[model samples]
Target: MVHSDEYKAKRLERKKRFMQQAKKNNVFKARRRNNFSKRPNFHNHQQENQQEQQFQKQDSTALRQRGFFQVLPTDDLPQVPQCSHGPCLLFEKKNGPEVEETFFACAIYRNQAEFCDFKLTFNKETGEIEVKEAVEGEEDAEKKKKKKKIFGYNRIPKALTEMSPTDTVLYCKTCINVFPNKHECVCEPVEREALERPTHLLPPVNEQHGESQFFFSTETLDVITKAVEKSKVDGILCIGAPRIFENIRALHPEKNVFLLDYDKRFAKFFPSKQYAQYSMLVDHFFDKIAEPKLMEFFDKSKSILMITDPPFGVFMEPLLKSIEKMKKRFVSTGKEETLFYSMIVLPIYIRKYVLHGNFWMSDYRVTYEGHKLYQHSEKTIVRLFTDLPVECIDLKNVAGYKFCEVCDRYVTERNVHCDRCQACTSVEQGKWNHCEKCDKCVKPRYVHCAQCARCHLYGRCIQKHDE
Candidate 1:
């Protein structure tokens, strides 16, 4: 008898579930077995055998020495057993005549666990041992320069000079540079209430948010101001950072600045007309753009400029999806541009993200006022990724900008000035090839595959081999 299609489908589903469960159980069992194999057994036969041999050797040595030596007795002398191992210099003071008066110790320098070869000199008079690290010579600096040349740009360039302070513009304490004012100094004295406000006004400290809500420095705010003024940005959409929205609004009150955040507390800071709460994690908010409430918040006619500091640990997918939803509402027709500026606040960990043709990185190290979660008194270094080109701003003693030959201007980080191609390309670490056919430089190791009639990644196209 043949089974019905529905019945067979249900049967297949049950079989698939059972197979998955079986596979999971097998993996668990394998892991358990591997863990058990790694554990050291206390009653190991080999260790016990070694101990037995040691005892036997001691007994035989005692027997051989018994007939050759005579025992001596002294009533005043303290009993001391001979050391089985060779005389250890670490305990030498205890064996000497001045044993009662002197102390002895031996420690691995700089907390090194293995192969400690450095000799530490001990002063008997002062009861101290001094250890100094070997000095780095001029050769070390030359080696560093050589390493920098491999990347085609200096990590620390000589061209960046210190800026002089001016009374006309307010200089950031962290960045130590006057705010650039082509028209007028947009910098205003922050109110005492705003400065003294609770840190909770920012995003909450949580794993999902990466606990990374830090206030931008005065200089960084100025940089934002310059970008806004230069691009003639009319509408601002701030995600996750309400403070940034406030700053932009204060600078350009005429511009339409809106704040979109997951937290409801941000609404108190901004007007009812400007602030809208939207959770990125919620599929209804991020995925649904046609919703009346969301549509009302985003206007289609205006050119929107979005600025955000997304959670570093969270994948870019959710953030991108949220941006897509916003763009659907705010993006205008014709030659109007929608600018996106994102901040990735992390230490020197290299993260390779998918970068589109529109994306351009900033060279300036954005200084951030640390929160309770980060608890750093000093401002943190943040990398800004933007679609708009920002004028190169350098922090004192920090190499933040690089000269781009193609753009005829100084571009930001992760951008290379390719001498061979005679253009500035976004190729990371200055790695690229000058494609003769394309008459341009291409990133990511692409080779000319004649059979494919285009350039493909090295060894990727099968048609090239077939040709």
Candidate 2:
């Protein structure tokens, strides 16, 4: 008994130390930063989430950690079994990031989304691929094939009328699938009776993986919904903001809200007609049928409003190219480029990317649901960048903002219009002080340096900043 007590004490101490180290290394992140972000992330290289460099026949082609789902220019692997993220890559047991059998995986594969089930066993010795038929019950197969169109926010599957009490109504969080009440699962399954509705059982994909999936707060969703409500367009394209898409659909049943997101779990909520698994950065659609639907929407609607909340640090160059491609595709359908405007939600720090695109940042701070930083208070970094007229932003509904006649823009009440600059100039963080030397308004933290002839942090000059 004394030995057992001693072992318990030592184990508890070890656990305490491990938790401290985890906190220090940022093991639990609110938002996953990209490889190029100023923020650094410590990955568990030996654990399940580790991504090792691929040593394959085609050395040039590799899976990008940044989650840019671009189709690689390689022919080493056969394209017969292509997944949503394009051609699958061969993963050998020897060079795998985690302990695994030799297999092929979707290029942008991640456990969080569980977006694709496109794993094929590849024998390194035999140089052959093994295909396994998915053996699902006929009832489950029928339930999957019966894609019910969700007309309203209360997305009750119409086919549920046939569901009996003995049906597989229990949801297993570990497997992210519904199972029979008595069926074996990794953990205790959530009872159907415990939920307010069956749709409530659809677990939120809150984990950070290849792409960050921070949902918008109810307040943020309300603000965006108001904006969509005032729009003249009947078609709403929610590129990455699923919350916004659902809200728009719920409130305005007259209008159609289409969701184009990378999260495959969202498929359970929405029908294929309304939702498409897509990577906006590379402008690739996971489903072949998705394009025609979007094109049809574009052709039918006289005008469409695009509101995107893309992952942070997404390659702006390719994103712009994708937008341009959308416009081109619309034009090719023998229809004039409809009145398509965009409202992109991004960090205020990366305003340089949208500088020349006729995109202007509204004074309204875009808050999020589960994001650690952009939740509330002074740390609100996300803003609604839009191509719509400044007057279109209804700051009157929200607080802390007013319309500036001189600047012809909506700005925070803290922002003082700079007559010399002829612009509001103040960003989302707070008010900015105008520097006569730089002839522009800079952040409150920046100091005008005479030597560098620019506004920057104290003791940090451009010459030595890189060092």
Candidate 3:
């Protein structure tokens, strides 16, 4: 008994010494710094105040020198309510040393009224102003008010429904033809050789390897474009959607766009230098194949943007892990202020990995380009989780979601919009669980049972039916 106790004591001592040594290592210190550095900085108040003062001074000087006080003589400036100093301004005036003849532009008149009819031109040599009225046709006015129609399953013409199956092809939400059809759609044929292995390695679809294709609608791409443009993102990393990559490249040709996917076929679409083949299923996938290339891209610039539509079932873990790896590689110590934006499209129910409070959820449902009516009862209520501020997006045009006045963005908890149910379920309860099959949210611990045709609590199904 004495000998056994001594052995155990020695073992414990050795383990303790090993841990002590590990703690002393530089790698361990780096890991600790990475984890704890994300905490809110409480000591920067003085520095922040100085920066704000300097910024205000610079902004006031710039606004004043831009000839904001010089009004066109021919045009009439609309009268508006005046403040104690002058006219009510759209932008707040600085309280520092005031410039001569500088007055604030009327907030309502400058913004609310139509400005397209008036054009202002300056002559450099003569220092003269030219004000011309723009002559626009009724057709031009109609076009300006019309919202660009987004192409989706909902937008398919009713006449297409009457067409014979022989003459029309059934396209999935991703715009892939899974059913029998004779009509030739615009979808490109799958490059069998380009797939790293097969479709089985991709996601939820465990079937035989074939054409596993999905494309983004034009309207969806437009929203993405606006977000990227507003954010001023210079480097983009796209995961699954090739159509997104193509559109992003066209929109911002100067920006560095990299594509990482299991589809080797993307090599043909983009130069070999721009594409990298990666399987998300493999552990440490980014470190093994993506790290070097990512470092090279990230080193070129600090502003990096990532957009991904991860596969169903196991989306959050691998996707978040990949994001952490990217952050570690790109964001070094003292570079926490580096602008990083991520736009993730995943089902609303998967909220386990969302414990980190850095992301904001969009209230709208994402309708994929080729989503078919038979496969999905309604458009899937996928959330657009992002770190960017809500002000970067125009909430009205984004669809199905609204900006919260309190949070300033569509948050995951307490702000969910159900399109099919036509309700905003934002009560005092925790986040709602959306069931795609039922086309609405079910109470916590409850699931939609196909047999009973309604959501029921787990392990308490009263209606006995075959699975």
Candidate 4:
């Protein structure tokens, strides 16, 4: 078959365009690779890297001043201060309420409208946060920043500013450049980390992972433990603590200890009876063990304090319950011990469970995910705790799909989908991965000739619940 003249000409033009584009792409890739390879020999690269480190240090210091931390002169940011007990970036408000919300990257304060008892303040004069005057122009300036038309400002959190892409007019310690955005910066994580949080006193957590000193950074761990211990909480309960919790226990053994997890293997490390004393609720982090179910173990009469690394997104349960009990008793009374305490790292599957109500605003140590993957803010923490109730729901709605402990949700022969497959089953499989062949959940090591795009487990990854 012969093609028409117009078709042939058009086809040739298209081919020429494709070749040019491909050639351009290849050239760009080559240049990028060459530049990366020569970076070590480039003295400017080292100098830029050092400058970035200095900028990050400045930004990190600024971060601690959430409501507004003081920016010591470029020459005078004190030696990361003596954070031997708490977080280096953390600071005491010095004058406000005894317990001020903790900000990972910023200082937080409350205006009089939010709290009638006393307005929280940040004193630049005394470095003491006190109840004070409404600074004129400050609110307007901040509102102006908020009102600016920026595509990602709504999605991007204020906490992310210090860590986000380096901005030309704003603080971005990563690239050491005053560039408007981080999109093109070629800064390394090490340089970023250095700028975000000075490590003059302690090395990176990874290098010290196995070593006892690194494993237990006395400064950080002690600060974390003391922060919890000093709190007004009555008895403390810790679950699925990973190895870090052990450090907490070693530091403050007097705090009540309860090890709750599905990991029966750890039970072997402790003698049977001792382990038994520490109640093992035998629930996965993702399981929505009903609040009523938890009630059986809770003594509502006592000032009970609870803690757990709840599956992601479900951290709001305990706070909601505490608010519920608050209607009947004083919040400061510790009446909701069954559902209150410090940090809880939830997994992705169960993260959205907390969005149904005002429970998202419970005041506590920190509602945080480990690894600092995103913006860490004390303002977010405080907002979560102090917000008033607008609506309430039975906590189980957020719990997620349900399946009995002894059900086979995965067994199928004729292209079957199990309706009973509720919670994740791969915990039993010991390995979790996508199966390109089955187009379904399967062991990570599955080998097959054909591949499918869908996951074999929950089918396709369900959209992360709208948080």
User: Which prediction has the highest lDDT against the true structure?
Assistant: 2
Among residues 3 or more apart in sequence or in different chains, the pairs in candidate 2 whose N, CA or C atoms overlap within 3 Å are: 217-369
Q: For each candidate, give its TM-score against the true structure.
A: 0.42, 0.63, 0.44, 0.26
lDDT of 4 by residue, 271-292 (tens): 2211221111212122223223
Global fold similarity of model 2 (TM-score):
0.63
Error of 3 at 199 (Å): 16
Tens-digit per-residue lDDT, 428-457, candidate 1: 434566777877776666777776766876
| Per-residue lDDT over 141-250 for candidate 3, one digit per residue giving the tens place of the 0 to 100 score | 55654534222221223334455556533433243322234334444333322222222223333222212354555656677777788888788887765667767776
The C-alpha RMSD in Å for every predicted model, in order, reads 30.1, 13.9, 26.2, 25.7
lDDT of each: 0.47, 0.66, 0.52, 0.34
lDDT, residue 444, model 2: 93
Can you list the residue pairs that collide in candidate 3?
A: 172-370, 173-370, 173-371, 175-370
Model 1 RMSD vs true structure: 30.1
For candidate 4, the clash count comes to 29
How much does candidate 1 score in TM-score?
0.42
Q: Judged by lDDT against the true structure, how good is candidate 2?
A: 0.66
lDDT of 2 by residue, 1-467 (tens): 45788899999999999999876555323123233344433454453243322222323223221222222222354453555465554444432234346666654452223665667776656767786765758457546545453333213243233457666565556544454445576645455444322224455556554466777877787777777777777889888887788777766878866888877766655667788888786577867778998887777766778888877755466566677787676677675664777888988788788867677888788887667888883578788888876667777766777888998766788888888888887774467888888888988999988777788876456333332
